[model samples]
Structures are given as C-alpha cells and as structure tokens.
Target chain A: MSLFKNDSDFKMDVLREVGNIGAGNAATALSTLLNKPVDMAVPTVSLLPFEAIAERVGGSEAVVIAIFLRVDGDAPGNMFFIINREPARRILQGLLGFDAAENDNYSELELSALSEIGNILAGSYLTSLADFTGLHMSPTVPSLAVDMAGAILSYGLLQFGTMGDDALLIDTTFLEGQQEAEGHFFLIPDPESFDKLFRALGVPL
Target chain B: MTEGTLIKVGMADLNIADGGAMLRTTGLGSCVGLTLYDPHLKLGGMAHIMLPSSDIAREGQLNIAKYADTAVPELLQRMISKGAVTGRLLAKMAGGAQMFAFMGGTDTMRIGPRNVEATKLALERFEIPLVSEDTGGNYGRTVELNSLTGVFSIRSVQHGVKEI
Candidate 1:
C-alpha cells in the first residue's frame, strides 16, 4: 500500500511504459515464431485485489495453460505467459506442424514446445527490459502448467501477499492478427522492487 | 432449507457459514484452504491462507486471514461468535500443493508444505483435532466444506472430486 505512497498515477504511467516496451518485444518474438503479424494492446498497470487478478485471464476456476518463471536480479519479480486452450492448440498445430489434440489433455511434447516458446518470448522481454533499465534481470527456467487461472496466477502473487491483499501488476494482452486473443503477459514485481525500478528509471521517489 | 448455498471465500480471506450453507475456496495453489466445522451446531468456517506466518507481513494494515497463524485464530473467533464451540470444532483442509517444482529451488514457491505445517501448528494451539486433510500434491485444488454435515470435499483438475 505504502509502496505507492503518493504519485500513484505517475508511477502507474511509468509501469505502463515498462510493460509497453517489454510486451512489444515479446509480441515481435511471437510474430517471428508464428510467421505472422502479432499485435499487442496497450499495457495496463493497476493495483488489483487478489480475486480480480484472476479475472483478468478468465475466472478463478477457468482452466488455461500458463508458463511461469521467476525473475531474479536487481528488479526481481514473477512473470507469466498465459494462453487459452484454443490458442495453445492452434499454436501447436499451426507453428510446429503437429496435429494438436482437440481434447483437454496436452501431450508432454506439446507442453515442452509451448514452454520453449514462452522461454523465447520472456527472454526477449527481459533482455529488452534489462537493456532499457540498465539492470540485470535474469529468468529461471520456465515451468508450464495447465490448470485453474487463479491457481497458476496466485503463485506469482505470493511474494506480494506478505505486503497486502492487493497487488500491482503490469498486464499486456496479445492478439493474433488483431482479432483472436492469443495470450497475456503479466509482470508482477515484488513489493520492494518498485523502489529499485523507480530509482533506476529516474522517477521521483 | 433448500440446497446448501455456496459461500465463496477468496484468497487471503476467511468466512463462516451455517444453516446448511457451504464454504468454498477456489483455485488454491501453494496456499492452504482450511475449514473448521462444528457438527453439532452445523456451523463451518473456511480461510484461504496464503502464507505460513503473519510475522512476514510488511503491510501497514495487517490482514490476519492471509496467514495461517493469524487466520486460524481469527476464523475460530468468528465461528465461536456464531455459537460454535471450540471443543466441537474439527478441521479439514486441502490445497497447499507445490504447483511448480524446480530442481534445487529454494522453498520460496515450495511454501505449500510450510503453509500446511503452520496451519496444523495453529490448530494445535486450540487443541482442535484435524479430522482429515488432502494436501501436498503438484497440482491445484478447489475445496468445499458443507456446514450441515461437515463433509469436506476436494476437487482438482488432476484428481476428480474426493471427500475427506
């Protein structure tokens, strides 16, 4: 709560810029991977309650595929690449040239392929962010899971749980051909990391 | 009455239900969903605990329901106000799964087990017996507790509905 102290609007704008830059590169990576144009919406940064956080993707009980990774370095945080089941199946079938099953169950190979895709997109995102902020941010190996959106996204919020019931998240949505929603990129920096992020970017503390 | 009503409990929250109402918390991963029930009074309480201890809290206004140590007592107090006796209270918990397991990873995200252990320790302070639990897996769970019958049911994506 005090993390914002004041100047929350300005701080949110700064965070929105951060998301814009990071997700821009990720969308570029996805475009290259799929050999098609991928458009990303303007990033939104908000302080959301724990329940509403899951509503961003779908609902608490909505099952989806998520690739999670922990970012460690100057501005440590959690990152997630979440996609709906239909888009995941499409990516597998269209990009990798595999007959992705229509059923709910995903094959091990399909999962790994999706993980690798997340790795590349997240890598591009972090690298660009690190370059922009001049801070060293590295991502752990990505882990993939297909489960309830609340369950998967809640893992990213545990670090923030100690501070308050609400968390600040930078969310960016990706659209394939500017029509079909593909996935979302959520960047939730730890509670303490906001200071470091602000100082690094020369925003007034 | 009619069928039991589902009183949804969000993360970092707790609730008490009675009169055949159901206490439910959804999408619990690396967090514990603890339910305390009094069979005689037909009263039940559920807290979706996110952390193991309140000592780690750095917020200005401490949310007691978010941590195991504080939530257990808070939920008990609420149930007691609803005419439920501590002696008659029994616990049934689920969730607290490791969700994502990495090699040589710190206990950061692996806090599911610690949440369970802390919740158990908190229950010990009241001398309330833990009747059953469905915890410590590598998946997610949505659990519900029936106030009338004290029936704790756990539902997961990997495992279908199972009652404890």
Candidate 2:
C-alpha cells in the first residue's frame, strides 16, 4: 500500500521547490538590509497536519512577530511569516546598530524600522514564491506580539481556520556575519485555497 | 534601616505597607504590576496579577493578587486597612506586556491589555486618580517600591536597561 494515495506527494514537491526559491530571495533582501554577506540555508520544508502545529511550536514563553498575506484567487489562500521575539529584537538591533547603553527601550523609531524590515522580508519571500509558482498575493500590515507559542498559533489558526488542513511549513535560518535569525514560512490553504494553489502550480487534485 | 519588612506576596496576596512598610514581588512576566500610594499618608501598596479576570481563575474564589479584577479590589481593601483613605490615594501602574514574542497579535490573546484595562477600571471605580503609568508594551518589567519614601522604580530590558 502506498503511503500517499493521491497527488499529495506532488503538492509537497511543489511546496519545497517554491520554498527554496523563497529562501534565496529572502537571503538577498536581508543581505541588502545588513550591507553584509548574508546566507540563508535552503529551507527544510514539510507537510504538517493541522493538529501537530501547536505541538511543534507551542507553549514556549517567547515574543513573536507575524506577517499575514492573502493570495489572490476566487477563494484566497493565506501565508504567514513568523519569527520568535528574541530574534526579532536582535535583528532590529543588528539592522539599526543602536547602542544598548544609551537606550533602555525600543524607541518609536526602532519599532518603525522593525516593521519595515518585516515588510521587506515578507514581500521578498512572497514575490519569489509567486515567480516560481505563478501565483500572486499581497500582505497585510505586520503585527508584533509578546506571548506564548500556543496563543500565537491559536490566533493564526482561528483566523485562517481549517484552511491549514493541508499546510506546508518551511523553516529557515538567516545568517548575517555573526548575527543570525530564524523564521517560519507557513503556507495554508482551505479547500478553495488549495484549488487556487493547485491551479497555480499546474497540478490537478 | 528597619530591615525593610519583606512581604513575600505568594500567588494571590495583595500587600499594602504604610509609613515604613515595603511590599515586593519577584519573577513576573505577562502579568500586571500595580502600585498605589498616598503621598500624604506615606502609604502604598502593590499587586501582582497573573490573569485579567477572576472568572477565569482555575482556582475559584479570587485571592485578589492572582487575577486583575480581584487583585485590584483586594489591594484597595488592604490599603484602606493600612490607613490609605480613598480620596488620598494616588495610583502609578506598570507591567502588562507580552514578554514572549510567540504569542502573536494583541487581538488574539489580550491578557496584557486586559490586565491594564482591569487595573484602570478598578482605580476608576474607587475614584482614585491614575497619576502616571507605563503599560502595554512588549517587555517584562521588574518594579520596586519604597514605602517610607513613597518612591517607585521599574527596570526592564527592551533594547537595553530602562527605568520608569
């Protein structure tokens, strides 16, 4: 008996291909921002059952930054850009070169800069994905959070709902000289969204 | 030096110290830290609330210091017991931030915001004026208040060491 009876393997392959392209694009954008040599490892992509997401990234007391994007279609799909808080702060500090001794808190200027950084990263990843898979999507304004993993994933799952039943997660690490950042790229699709993704990838369900 | 009587507020104990009483709590995250003081009476109190509402308390019947709603009232009662009359009390608040980033947007889980909101409401219900506050940001704050001097300070690391 075959483990995957349908076109699931095909879909997974397309996701990995798109993830590789997205990771490359993200690396370029980050390198430009840091004005240094930046390397992003080829993402490790996998298909995750919706129920396992909480267990995979839940309950850790960490801050998170998330960016949501809506893919264009008759029934739109959603993509997420998620990062842990410590990395978010460190990334901002590295990108801005702000001195810690002089400032004891995130100035409004720093918040703006971090938001812009999120926009660039999310935009580049989606743009590359679109180019590779022939799909188009636009993102909402990024939001910041300081909470447990369970809360963050729960919120995303609720908004996107059972759409993530057939989800793909791409995990990658970004390195800029000695500073490093970790990120998660989640591709979620409902039945309708899955149709759009299949159409874009030229795969039949 | 009075050895500064250390009031070890367990999970839900609202402690009020007046004129030579010092109230303190250790290791706080994603909880609201509230300080109410009366400059005239040289009395003050602090409550460390773990959640926003007593209704959600896994342990029924609020202990005051555990949840925001119950804790605020309990703090007030204790302050009153310590001779902090309602009209004379002045409030200064701090904490209530999503200390961990993985929690996501404020709209999703509002413990931090709710705690801040509940504290404000409780103060308003008693007609106490909130003088100054540092709340609703993405950082954990550790605070210390001196009962004798009525001076309070909060220290946290966001980008660096910050005192408010």
- Go through the candidates in order and give the C-alpha RMSD of each one to the true structure: 1.2, 10.7
Residue B68: error of model 1 in Å?
0.7
Estimate, for each residue in A1-205, the C-alpha lDDT of model 2 and write its tens digit. Answer: 1223487777767656766787678778877886767776656656554335534543222444555454444434455666655666666768777642133255677666766776787788778776766766665566544334433443343322212232445556565566545566665543345566667777776
Query: DockQ (Cα-based) per candidate?
Result: 0.84, 0.04
Whole-model lDDT values for every prediction: 0.91, 0.60
| TM-score per model over all chains | 0.97, 0.49
Model 1 / residue A5 / CA error / Å:
2.5
- Alpha carbon deviation, residue B71, candidate 1 (Å): 0.7
Q: Give residue A173's error in model 2 in angstroms.
A: 3.1
lDDT of 2 by residue, B1-164 (tens): 24377665432346777657666653344566788888887888888765666555432233456667677778888878867788988788776665434324444245567778887888888898988887766655556677777666666544433444
lDDT tens digits, residue span A102-134, model 1? 677778788899999999999999999999999
Scoring model 1 with DockQ, what do you get?
Answer: 0.84
Task: Give the 10-residue window scoring lowest on summed lDDT in candidate 2 chain A.
Answer: A157-166
TM-score of 1: 0.97
Classified by CAPRI criteria, candidate 1 counts as high
